[model samples]
Target chain A: MTASSASPYQRLHVELDARRYPIHVGPGLLDTPDMLVPYLAGRQVMIVTNETVAPLYLERLKRTLSGDDRDVREVILPDGEHTKTLASVERIWDALLAAGFNRRCTLVALGGGVIGDMAGYAAACYQRGVAFVQVPTTLLSQVDSSVGGKTGVNHPRGKNMIGAFWQPRAVLIDTDTLATLPGRELAAGLAEVIKYGLIQDAGFLAWLEARMSSLRGLDVEALTDAILRSCAIKAEIVARDETEQGQRALLNLGHTFGHAIEAHQGYGNWLHGEAVGAGMLMAATLSQRLGWLSSEDMARVETLVASAGLPVTVPAAMSADDFLAAMRLDKKNIDGRLRLVLLSGLGEACVYDDTPPDMLKALLDEFPRA
Target chain B: MTASSASPYQRLHVELDARRYPIHVGPGLLDTPDMLVPYLAGRQVMIVTNETVAPLYLERLKRTLSGDDRDVREVILPDGEHTKTLASVERIWDALLAAGFNRRCTLVALGGGVIGDMAGYAAACYQRGVAFVQVPTTLLSQVDSSVGGKTGVNHPRGKNMIGAFWQPRAVLIDTDTLATLPGRELAAGLAEVIKYGLIQDAGFLAWLEARMSSLRGLDVEALTDAILRSCAIKAEIVARDETEQGQRALLNLGHTFGHAIEAHQGYGNWLHGEAVGAGMLMAATLSQRLGWLSSEDMARVETLVASAGLPVTVPAAMSADDFLAAMRLDKKNIDGRLRLVLLSGLGEACVYDDTPPDMLKALLDEFPRA
Candidate 1:
């Protein structure tokens, strides 16, 4: 562990110019006024959250941010992927206007990935962009979404079909917030954590293999280590390719297949992480067939994801044609060709644009009964 | 004139990295396919325009862009500032989705500032941004909005209150399009053309003074020179400060008051150019009040604006309090203090945040009966 992690907390820096910010991971970070208040660019702030998260954390965060001089307001939406729409974002805009928020006003996203994406996009468009801070209260958000600059609401036709690469001013991840996370949501977050290992860090995969049980048991040290490492990996990639013209596409390792599942089954039917877990396994099947990854390693990859309580099997009702049609609609596809991220080995991945259709079909066949 | 302008048309380059693009200013450009087709990034093109502009130019543009292999779509919206809303942008989004446009697909904005703003903003958000080209047909768009990377829809409370600084791949300015433009709209464009001269180019202002009659007569050469010089000046400023952190704010020499007028009068009630023309005079009044501009120089500025057929006086109905309240709501203000872009001298502007309230009050009183 680094020296920062050796203390009660860990702080990692995202070094993108002008947009450079810190991600602080520690216990009870939400209670620490110093972690969030100093990052506010103005006295006005709007905390955007969803119903599920609002009941648990909104009032507490409001209390922490409230003061005689500050103007703090809260805007809440119904909790679900269906709600990640332009209409939902209009509520935030209307609220900000009602509160007379200006260009210098800050938007603080105080929930999971949905809140973060919606609020980040709101800040990006409000007065041609405003400062925003991410208070990610979910493991999924802290480890993935909140660390990177991608933010948007979804269109009915696709997940994250609309968005911008608007980075947050800072990220405050309180590990204590994870205590309220449901098991399924927690497992969803681990899928992305495992992704960092699968894509760039072989050693991290080995480490995750050893600590899976501790993570499931809600061990604070394990959770902290997972989030810190995941954020560090994401921060590194995002800093290098903020606009995703190149290497950053590798971060979408399972997202093409995962998004297809989410869109096919209807968003929110399959939790994003669950679909990604199963999708990663499906991608591994293709990688094995292509001879980049051995069959044994592919099975091992499946086992790790399965052990995390994430679905390794695609839903039984979806046929190969169904998956094919959905995958073809992914935004990553260019000129009618599906570009996918496949494992070169257990700990390494690369984007491949020349995937054979037969191999994709063969891989989909194996997942149909799962 | 530069060698490029020696021909029947002229081309100016905006040199911002990656976002660097050419601004082509000339006559009869809409009749030429080479001016547009070469800049398209893909076979799929969505041309966004408005009702008034569509009847006049849409079919001609479509005819120029059409081919057996290319997929071209057109989205025509109601013509006015009110239609520049999130709901209106949703129409473009829906049209793109319905036609299955992808990341590589290019959006071509084919009208005035409103079309460019909405289309550019749609391009910025669609699939986290796709390539777009601007075919700015109006004078205001050619000189100002189309050159800078600002794109967005207006909020109910303010003009251009929601947007992104997403640059287009290229800008195609056809001075021939001005032949069909309404006299009022033409004058509105002149307001911005004069703005460039007022802010950074006294020599350009002198040139405009000599050629104002020719430009008002829509003489192709005069119009072309005015646009080419104006775009070059804007391009330089935009390249230096893509985001309005410092120098870029100087480009808003009259916008702080102009937006206030537009927002208070209800956007479209006062044309953007008219508001800006009057607002520039108001800013000049403040400059003179602060002793930065001599009374004689300020009157010359007002005379130039009046010659262009734009309002040089604030409307009689707006009280000092009304203008003050409206200006206070401007996004440029920081920490509740209005930051006026005041003329330091003829052809030189600077952002001044410490403008005395009394000076602003005095300027408003002067405009009540102009």
Candidate 2:
């Protein structure tokens, strides 16, 4: 069916000059051929999804993409964050080569953040980059990973240590896919949606607080609004700073501490958003210590995080030193100085490299543990 | 020493807007810290070289880069075309992380094509690309790979099937290194020099024809001039088509057939330039068959390739089917059509996707076997 006849959706563009593309958010987008067909680089399409997503949506996506003139294939990788490695991407590359796909081909990432990240990265380097369309199935991926064009696999040493900022031809968010999402996974995704508010939009945070129940209940309208607003904020930031030169680093609001948690716990143990949820609270707490946020502001952050069903405390086993060790290797750091995205106010995030070491250590040591 | 006092060098820019960088060709550039220090992105520097190149120039390079505030490290990988893989690049990332090298870190690729390609790719993906300086020591790399931003690793299925077009901060070519290059390797470098002539500059081809022995004998002036001319032609093409949208494909005149030969023989067996040498002759012959070149024109290509000490035949074991199979997977092809860069005339090339299969099979079937 054509987009005109399909269910109504909100569209936003990541304004990247020549690489600008649209992100369409609505239900049943997976079954809409016109939404996807135009953005394809060529007739060859490789659908990279996880085993978890294939049974539910693969055939439908293939049917939408397949035609006599097109050669559509799929590589169903094993699921989870642990599988986000170069080895899995290599599998995608191997499959592309095995099928004799050329530079003109397009890769359709049809799963969550892991699938999208791996597939986008595979496309980024396959024949020095091919076109890729992000079909983010998870709520987390929809509101976050799919829009900004940051793609890569995880390293044993750190999260997203190796990757590229390759923009996608388009992003098709089929909100209907969230029906199969697990409750914990859904909560994980809400963490990022909440993140948009904490980092850039105070009004959105208030709106999210009011609609938290609707969001958690999977109210289609609430979820759609959240995704739209989140994408709008991210797209603006990415357009201004596509490669994270300066302002873009502010998007990592809780990522530095969150990465430390994920790395310390070992990836795949703590969901990225869960770690971010707790890490955001940690940042808020640190901001409180630094006089950037008031006690009431920190309380509000804690309440919002806890209400979203995300952890608001640090992983119990991690120590201040463990956090420091991992944070030192974060991609945001430079010249051996730790750079972190911290809130100057409820909605004002800033990248600061001057977080006093002693103060940071105190906060990490005192932060509540799960 | 400064570039001014450091044995005068020729410098050219790869005009890529904000990403534009310079290519410096001269002797003793490795020892000139001023040439490299200014291009570095930050204080952390990681030099990625191969075992072969490490013993030869690693110390000299390290001494030049080391300082009180700078963190200079090295990852010496096993040397060979076979070592160019994601696994090797991972080692570079591993070392970078171990050293806590952040996004501000600069990667110095101090070796030939393999080391440069792998290091450049590692830098391209490390923290979504850090700055990299190409210090290509081999003749072929100085004239070809190092100048262009095309960096990648080989897959068992195809050569350079996985990679990126990440530009370097600068490329420093120290001609003095050629004095230690192996005879076979020197000849291999000459093959690419001859290619610049066949693909774009007939005048340079004639010059090469006249000074082939001088170049082979490592006459510094002749080699420097050849490198300069070759780089200028490549920079012009790359500036016009950084992503190989059109004009840049001309540079791959022999690479399609050359890649087939390399894939069939297994990588590392035949040097890239050696394969391209043979591949160029094949393209010239096919151009002759297609009525684009005179018989005498084809003979000149053969003589030039032979004089450069490059093979003028396909791998003995590869049949027409082998060539067809490998060439089919070439990155240049579109929608399963075999795109070959064939000579339209001496010093002129065009990407033709309409090579009748029957004619391609005939040419491959009849081409001489090494």
Candidate 3:
């Protein structure tokens, strides 16, 4: 099915001047072939996908852009979050060079957030920043990674430790792509969806709660509208503070805690969306303890996450101390101080530098029981 | 021993608006402490040097940058052309991130072309590109690598195969930086210097012939003026076309042949400068064979390189076929066709795509037996 232009998909643009991009979200945006051709610049196109999603929707997307001047190539990487490693990145770069790709080539990332991040980074490093298009195939990616130009492979020591802020030429999010997604993956995506509400748009959070059941059941209109709104909000925030300085740090409400869980559990054990879901709840739990959040607000976050079928608590295996230790090494950490993005309330967060030890201890203590 | 502001040196400006950089070259330029301040930005500067050059001048440069807010951190990598791999890049990135570097940080690359290339790539990759200053401590880096913003790490499959087109904030040359350089390195640097003459400045080539003995002895004025003029020429070419779309290819006159040699011989065995030196001779020889260059013009290139203590002929161990095979895999090669930068005359080069194989073969057969 082609994307319906009638869907509430607004184009959120990245302000990179001549190298700028647009994020298009709606039901059939993927079928809009003409929108992407301008940036291709008569260059060869490489669509990088993965196995799991390829069997589902890669063909229709490929058929959309089969034009006379555009010569398209495909390289499918192994599927999953764990594949975002240096080995994979090297493979992407090598494959592109071998294919006679030059400065005039465009890389299309066609899976989920993993493909988008790795492919975007590969484009950035390939001949030093080529144009990339994000055909984000997952909800987490459509709402998050696809919009921001943060691309990289994971280091053994840390996540996205080696990366670049490479912006993509355009982000095409087909809501139809979501129809083939597994229920668990779809729910995992809601974690990020809910995250937007808690961090930047509390009103979106309430809308999510009211329409939670319909979204969980995959209502096409609601899903596309939700994805576009999330993209627009994220685009505005990124435009203002492209780098995670002041306002952008708010976007990481659940990420500091989320990174610890992902790194501690080892990548791929829990989906990144799952880890962020738990981390978002932890942030809410800590906020309640700090008296910045009421017990009702914390419960509201937990109830919303639970309704979306996301895990709402930390895993029993990892000690809060280990989580703290892992978080201290986060690239976000300033000097020796552990900087965490704490919520002032729902729909707001600020970078909290040098949090008192007692507050950290109290927060960790709350992670186990509350 | 400070650089004389009055009559001795020429200042060439690289104007990219806010990213503008000044190329300061003259005798004793290293001792001019104030010249270092403009590129430093804030206070902290990290000096990335290599084992070969560190023992000689790292302390002097560090002392020059020392004051109240400006503290210098030094990282020394192993010496050799082969050390420009991604591993070295990781070490540099790890060092910078571990040191709590923010976006405002500046890096000073203080060695030869290898050190300059590696450090500049690191600065470009770290935190998604930072301001890096090139304090080229070798002749090759001072005159050539310092002026160009091409920064990258070498991949095993290809040299500079994975990189970005990042420009340095400024390039500072202390003719004194060349004093500690060994004979082989000094000769390697002149290969690139000779390129400027063969490609754009025939007068400069003739001047080199007349003062061959004085230049070999490292006469301060002659050396410094040559470096400044070479940079001025490169700065002009680069300002017009930073990316090698058109005239920029002219800069690769000897590099195509030299890269093939370096690839076939393995990178470290032939220094990059050494490879280029041999490559230039072959380029001139091809021009003469093509009947586009006079015999005298070809002889001038060979004699000047030989006088500078650089190798002016290909190694007999590698056949012409081996060199051709190596050149075909160069990043510049597209669709298995070899593109060469050939001299139109003494002072200009034009890129010729897919030169007749017989022409390349005949030049190979004539490889300097006498």
Candidate 4:
């Protein structure tokens, strides 16, 4: 194995036999390019990033990929949730084809969750699925979107409404990219970071509480370690249940409520992390109402989110009915019945169907604008 | 087990475990919807067919399905290959949502390869993969497209340019649909039947030579038995190599050349089988020119294609170079090198790479004129 492959973090493999790929994390790994070389066996490489991320490190990324064999190219998509549409995916396909790319090509996603999801979905559908590399530049993508094989473009009816479960050939989480991100974006990303703790990693959440300031300040070691821990946990969940029949639902700790808030707010109004941040708070409160979580445990979640600069309050204009209607439209719902990942305790969640809307709506009112 | 499931045919499952699906062939099976009750698992059912099919047998299929406990609905797509697009897939999704169909709902693709492929692709993308049943209603679909889980829409650049290998929960091949199919379409379907014999079943090809006339007359036992044999050979091949990494390429038969013809003639201009029909003749001739096939073997291929009333000659308007260019753009091309699946013996074939373009251009010129 190359020195680049032997990192301090644990590496998990999703074995589809030859299509297998690895998830790598930990500090001082991004600057090292050798780990990425083998997967880039094909000569041409297209780096897909967005406007919000391009200004910060596109040049440095280009430099790392500079080699005689590499015909490096870049396409900077407009940054936002709105850009995750078929039109954008077509644009990427057009560029790859115009660049003389065939099946033997690699597409590199170089942004946060939206960029990774869209680029990975394009990779999944392009020529009936090709190789893709994820270089996540945000905390949400590093810990969540980049690790799982779930990739897709969205429909007006729902988020990730159209897509495939195409895993990336490799994921490069350069925590260094965290340095220049907008503070709100950082806060939004932290909501996802906290989610790993809520869904399947309580200890990780506690670690985030003690290390929030270091992460926000871009202390390389702390952020890298946090991302590595998150990826390892997610990789285990995905390996056993790639199709999300059971255990995988736990990963959606705040997403059922989070997606409703994002859709109600018209996608871009709230960062995914922001809606998820506030949504997790609401879910925790509902857990308390159900006698599942203790009041003391709920207070701990609120304190951790606040210290990480995440929001713990829902927007004022939104009403409980809108949240319920939006939740009904969530992709997670089965047979028109709303199914949610409700916590029985921290580090555990069960997907409960037959959620009585009135009870949910009534409890949803309890967390209103306090 | 039902009497049919206990047959030697039924015990031979596709056998990919979770991705495993049974291909039920024989007459009267469509009316026996009881065969499908177990697979439905008490979920809602949506039958996706086309105008060509719905007018003929929708009520009967529904009556058969009425025995089940779940709700049954129908979505009719426009007939023909032209409708295999992202636009068409959106309609499936919209229909499901408008009808409040969710994850637990099972989609039954109730037409030819177009319906099976597009519906299967729709299921793969719907909520990031849902369970789908392939109720293949064409001779071509019964043998080939229905068995392999490869599903997707075409990109503007090529045919089947976008898709996935999302397997079915089960495939119900009702032989009765073949009786109502036009003779021309039935002939087109035979191209795949002939492909099986050409690839690895010389004895089956010989059997087809003897029974082609009976099959043409829609003799139930002869044609149904032919289809069962073809699907069995394909199912066994696909169960081992679902992704086309190795042995699966042998299944391509005339497809390397066939895809070029389909794309050059503009998909719908020629039925997929018509293209394969002509393409197979060209492949045999190319094999002869490459010093692989004897004169008698080449003659036998042309004789079978001619008897099926399918085109055994290329369109005069498309030049050899144009065909070559189209083939290069095919997903089958690897690392800019052309890979042609060539015949070695009467029934054995191999994927040959870096094929000589001049040889192909010359053979294109020497094909039998209509």
Candidate 5:
């Protein structure tokens, strides 16, 4: 169906010159051929999805891009964050080779964050990069990962450690796909949605505070608004610093700590967003201790995250030392100094490298594991 | 020793705007701390080399970048084209993670083409790219591979099937390193040098025709002059098409067929330049068949390649079918049709997608494989 005839969709653009693309959010976007047709560089299409997503949306997406001129193939990988590795990306490479796919072929990532990261990375390296489109099926990816051009697999020692900043030709976000999303996974995605508010938009945070219940209910209007706003904030930051040379690093407000939480919990255990939820709390507390975030603001931020059904505390087993060691491995560290994204105040985040180790340790010790 | 006190080095610049870097070609470059120290972004330096090169130049390179504040480490892999794989790159990742090397760390590739390719790729992906310098020790790498930003590993299916176009911060070509290079490997590198002549500068080809003896003898002046000219031609093409979307494909004149030969023979058996030497012969013959090259010119090309002590014949085992299958996997292929870099006439090359398959098959049939 043409976009004109379809239900109104919220469109956000990632304004990277020459490499820019639009993110379309609405129900049944998977079936909108017009949204996908213009971005396809050639006739060949390879939809890379996970086993979990394949059964539910693979055939549906295939039908959307289906045409006699299009030769579409699908590669279904096993699900989970652990699968986000070079080995998994190699599988995608092998599949493309086996199929004799050329540089003209465009890979469509049709799952959540893991598939998007792995598939996009595969596209980036395959023949030194081929065109790819992101069809993010989960809220986490649709709102956060898919919009910005961050794509890569994970190293065993770190999260999202091995990757490329490969932008997709387009991002198609079908909110209807969230019906299949498990409750915990849904809550996990909300963590990133809340992140936008804590990092840059105080107004958005207040709106999220009042509309948290509607979002949890999967209210289409509220969900679309949050995803659109979140993507816009990310897209603006990404446009300004596509390579994370400076301001782009601000988007990782909770990610440095969040990545540590996921790594400590063995990747797939805590869920990325859940860890980010708890990690953001730690960042807020740390920011407060550093005289950046006020105590009342930190309480409000923690309450909003807690009310979203996300974790507000660290896992019981990880110690302050463990947190320090894990955070040191983050991509933001420079010459052994840990650069962190901390709030100067609620709804205002900035990257800082001056967080004293003693204050960082004190904040970490206060969090009861688990 | 400092660069000022040593014999003046021949310097050439690759004009890529913000990514522009200089190529320093001379003896004793490894010991010239002045050339390397300025490019280093941080104190942490990871020297990536091969087992063969480690004992020879590793310590010399370490001293060049060494300072009390600098933390230096080394990662050595088995030396061979076959070792250029995703798995090999992972080992680099593991070492960086183990050492807690952050994004601030810079990787120095301290070997030939294989080392440069794998190490450059590792740097490209290590935390979504960090600073990397190329200290290419082989003739081929200094003249071609290292000068351009084309870095990647080989797949069993195709040479450089998985990689990136990650440009280096600088390329330090210590021609003195050639003293330790094997004879056949040296000849293999010369093939690429001859390629610059055939594809772009007829004058270079004629110059190489006369100086074949001096180059083969590893005369410093002749080698330095050749490397400078070859790098100038490549940097021009690369600046125009950093990502082989256009003019850069011309540099692959023999590489399309050359890669197939390497893939078929099992990479590392035939040195890259040796394969390209034969492949260029095949490409010249085919170009003649297509009426783009004169029969007399083809013979001159073959004679020049043979005088350089490189192969002019394909392996005795590969059939036309094998060539077709291998060439199909090349990155230049589009929509399953082979796009080859063929000569329009001597000293002039262009990317062509319309090569008649029957003529290609006939030409491949003429070459007896290994």
Candidate 6:
């Protein structure tokens, strides 16, 4: 870990051997050309963002990347999770082809997780893989999506049904960009921030519990510290299991249940982090039922999630069968068995495949609905 | 290298460290479950073939994979190079998801280069990649496409413009399948075989020159030898440069010109190997012009290609500009420079980014057209 003295930004490397890359977290990092330029494959750069983010940081990024010898272009797609699809990615490939971009060109994902994922996937397949950089603007993206190279689009059947683990050349997280984020989006990001603490770091969890109000209040120092810790934990895990064969699956502490909510509700209905927030609560409750976590532990999990401004209940219209139907299709399952990441205790997670069907059904049936 | 004494099949391994897998080449290997069963990730199996091959080999493959414990499903896509698009791959994903295939499932690609590429890509992105096996039925695929892990779909703008380097768990080449192949398709496959000789093996070139008639006549021994040699060369190249960072580009001996011919003619109009046949001749001609190959060497190249039943002339409708336009989009090029693989000698190839535009144009304009 290294923080530049001139700027307040801290840097962490995701050590993937030959493909190792750095994640820089700080205020106004996007405007720093020195942060992004070294990672670009060549002079041809394509900036992929959404309509919402285009008006926010697009020009500033362009100025930072612009030079006499470099050719930089931008493709602004419609915003929202609904827009994250192969067709939209095709548009990015089309723009690259139309511009006659070569194999050395770099794709800079300049928005939230949706943009980062689609753009990273586009880079993954363009000319059978090219270089890409992640400039995640949303708090959720800065803390999670941008660090690991899990890039893909959602299929109608599941979330991220199609994707590849193509690591980016660098991740630029500008805490300053969070200033323009909606309060709900900010809250959704805190869900993932809280996730890091619950899964691996009890001390970080206590720290976040203490500073949750300050983070929501947009205190720069508080936000930067939270982002750095989140990225560090994620980067370390990714370095150990770049392909998610074993220990890395623990990071999906809330995703299996969360994907069910996102899919049943239709993509983009509930923001990814928001669904994950509720899903974490459901997992904790289930853990308590399984005798893994006590009721008090479950309460602490719920209070922290709720205090972060996330929902703590399932959608009213969803049935236990709906959750079962969707969870069965999760990517984590193996050989028709539902494999889930569950909490063994605070700051510790384990994958369980033996959760009794009746127990799960009872929990789903009895859990409060929003 | 290991040859099973019970059957006449010879098995060679592609040494990719942890991802290393075996390539079994010989007749009737497809009927042996021992070849494929060990490589499958789990009990869920999806066989992806095309309409043309499904009728011929799908049932036989299913029978080979069938067991009371295994769940087998098949998706038969329409045949042809033009059908190789993101849409076709989407259909494969839809089938897997509809079948409730999970991360532990395996995809078996059972067709020509088009089917293999599409299926491999589908597996590459389906749940961010699962296990896959290559059961290539075409002569072109048996010795070339199946051995290297280059999987992708063609974008309208370019060939294999979207894809990933997802290796298969195994590559099973059933020589018996070629008994039903069209003569022209067989000739196309021969083009790639001849390419192996031209690019990396002088001894193999001499062997091919002597055995050209035997190979064309479908002498099982000659065909098997050729396939083994080609795969051996390809597997070695892929292992050294899995992602085409350097030495691997030499394998694209005639691909730059071949791709231009294919793209201008519209993908399926000219078979990939057929275009490559003509492209190889064009490369040799250019090499001769650059004083890299003597006139005698060029004549040997032309004689070998002509004897293989492949077209050595450019397409009649394509002009210099047409070739240049498509070649400009070749994936091997970097930073707007046109990179081409040219012969340093009869059996050795080199990548040259400094090919003078006028010399290339002159060759394109003067090359004989069919």
Q: Pick the candidate with the highest DockQ.
A: 6
The structural similarity of chain B in model 5 to the true chain B, as TM-score, is 0.96
Q: How high is the TM-score of chain A in each model?
A: 0.97, 0.97, 0.94, 0.93, 0.97, 0.98
lDDT of 6 by residue, A1-370 (tens): 3334455568778888988888888777878888889988899999999999999899999999988599999999999999989999999999999999988999999999999999999999998899999999999999989987999999888899999999999998888899999999999999999999999999999998899899999998999889988988988888888889888998898888898999999999999999999999988988998898988888889889999999998899999999999999988888989999999999999999999999999988998998
Q: Which ranges in model 4 have alpha carbons more than 4 Å from their true place? A: A1-20, A26-31, A66-68, A354-357, B1-11, B67-69, B368-370
- DockQ of every predicted complex: 0.76, 0.88, 0.36, 0.56, 0.82, 0.91
Kindly report the TM-score of the first chain in candidate 2: 0.97
Docking class of 1: medium
Total residue pair clashes for candidate 4: 0
Model 1 C-alpha RMSD to native: 2.3
lDDT of 6 at A21: 85
Q: Regarding lDDT, does 3 or 4 come out ahead?
A: 4
lDDT of 4 by residue, B220-315 (tens): 889877887788888878877887778988887788777877777788888999988888887777777778899999889989999998997777
- Per-candidate Cα RMSD to the true structure, in Å, reads 2.3, 2.5, 4.0, 2.7, 2.7, 1.4
In candidate 6, what are the lDDT values of residues B1-370, reduced to their tens digit? 3334455678788989988988888778889988878988999999999999999988999999999599999999999999999999999999999999998999999999999999999999998999999999989999889987999999888999999999999999989988899989999999999999999999999999999999888888899889988999998998898989899999898889999998888989999999999999999999999999999999999999999998988888999999989988988888878899999998899999888889998999999998
Clashes of each: 0, 0, 2, 0, 11, 0
| Displacement of the residue A266 alpha carbon in candidate 5, Å | 0.4
Between prediction 3 and prediction 4, the one with superior TM-score is 4
Each prediction's TM-score versus the true structure: 0.95, 0.97, 0.88, 0.94, 0.97, 0.98
Indicate the residue-level lDDT of B37 in model 4. 64
Model 2: docking quality category: high
How accurate locally is residue B61 in candidate 5, as Cα lDDT from 0 to 100?
Answer: 92
lDDT of 3 at B279: 85
